[model samples]
Target: MDGLAGIVREAGRAGDRVGYFAALYRQVTVEVRTAVHGGLFDDGARMDRFDTHFGNRYFDAYDAWRRDQSGPRCWREAFGLLDDPDTIIVQHLILGVNAHINLDLAIAAARTSPGEAIHALRRDFLLINDILARVVVTMQDSVDALSPFMSLLDRVGARTDERILDFSVRQSREEAWYNAVLLAGQNEEEREATIQRLDIRAAVLARLIARPGSLVRPALELIRSTENDDVPAVINHLDNAMERSSAKQGTA
Candidate 1:
């Protein structure tokens, strides 16, 4: 009912809890929508199609995974955690990112251009990454803004640590690109198998995020304890931060 947890929580109650990531994802589609209408990408039309097609796959999976209809292992693991009481906001974000980037992203890229056409897709592919990266940095800031403990978390270094920042999204994305390259050359059947393997591998990551060790668990608890819990406020702050970041880079 509340917008604080974003659309994801509402989806859970609706039996499609994947809405947890869907909320953030819906925000991404808006950003991509703007880019499409404004011709922000190199091959604007093609990228727009790619973005839309890619986003829809995730949305479909959200429903399927929710109902036990069928989906990737990584996504299943991520969705299963939506109602988890011990899961912190960052962990929820991480679970979504882990499934999307480590798993979904590679699949999207491969499916976008099978075989040699994949090479042609690379430039535009990275272009989309550029757009997402800027939003990501600001989303990082938004978390610190919406969550009380993030202020203290920010003091750890001259800057906030990357792990806590995007929860290693930056690092994971780099590997995703490499994995995508491999997927591009595979056949559909092979790609399907590969997806399952990646999902299995990604499931381990979701586990660590949800059930981290003692040292990390305490810090995760602090952030959850201090979180605002106002879903609309949190989403608004995140959207505003995304817009500001976009403007700074002239992407808006």
Candidate 2:
């Protein structure tokens, strides 16, 4: 968690757009760690291992991307957009989420619980959705601060807009779970093939997130126009908001 936070801080200091996702990811890790400490999972030890494996995928990819080395196609798609001035902050975050959740998560789960043992991980795995929902709600508030017009876009688009903007975390995670089950049942050779397919699918999703569609693009552009363009300041604000949210959650 400290290492993840360090990455977020360093990215922020360097005015890197990657910090947008890293900040949100650090918050998710913090919440997952807190849940583990609170005995939220059926097997805390196993959950710890699962969390570590899941996070390492992102950490490894981030390290590789920074070095201009090849990585998962989905992650490469996300990282490639970091320098695009036209791409809004929300797009950056969603690109990261699409890659991480759609591809890395399934692989991590399969690695954590191979074979029939994957069934045992179902309950705890579902619990992560709850944690994500909570963290994302709070993170949305932080994003709202960064882009006040987001609310206007939300009201204008309603459910259709939300589906486009939010990218349906619940649905994505559920699909990831199904993919994990499939991967768990496969041998190494088969699993690699499945992973390649998933990577392509996830990369496609990243492109959709980055480009969305005509219906939402104009509204997104409006929001982007109004957003705080200071990359480091935006990252710091998001990081601090997550910290404050964690403190409140701790007290509660």
The alpha-carbon RMSD values of the candidates against the true structure, listed in the order shown, are 4.4, 2.1
lDDT of each: 0.68, 0.85
Best by lDDT: 2
Per-residue lDDT tens digits for candidate 1, residues 229-250, read 6554554555456566667779
User: Residue pairs in steric clash, candidate 1?
Assistant: 3-231, 3-232, 4-230, 4-231, 8-19, 8-20, 12-17
Tell me the lDDT of model 1 at 162. 43
Task: Estimate, for each residue in 66-168, the C-alpha lDDT of model 2 and write its tens digit.
Answer: 8885799999989999899988877887788888899988888899999999999999998876776677778777887888788665566653324666477
Error of 1 at 187 (Å): 1.6
Stretches of candidate 2 off by over 4 Å are 155-162, 246-252
**What's the lDDT for residue 99 in model 2?**
86
The top-ranked prediction according to TM-score is 2
RMSD, model 2, all Cα superposed?
2.1
lDDT of 2: 0.85
Clashes of each: 7, 0
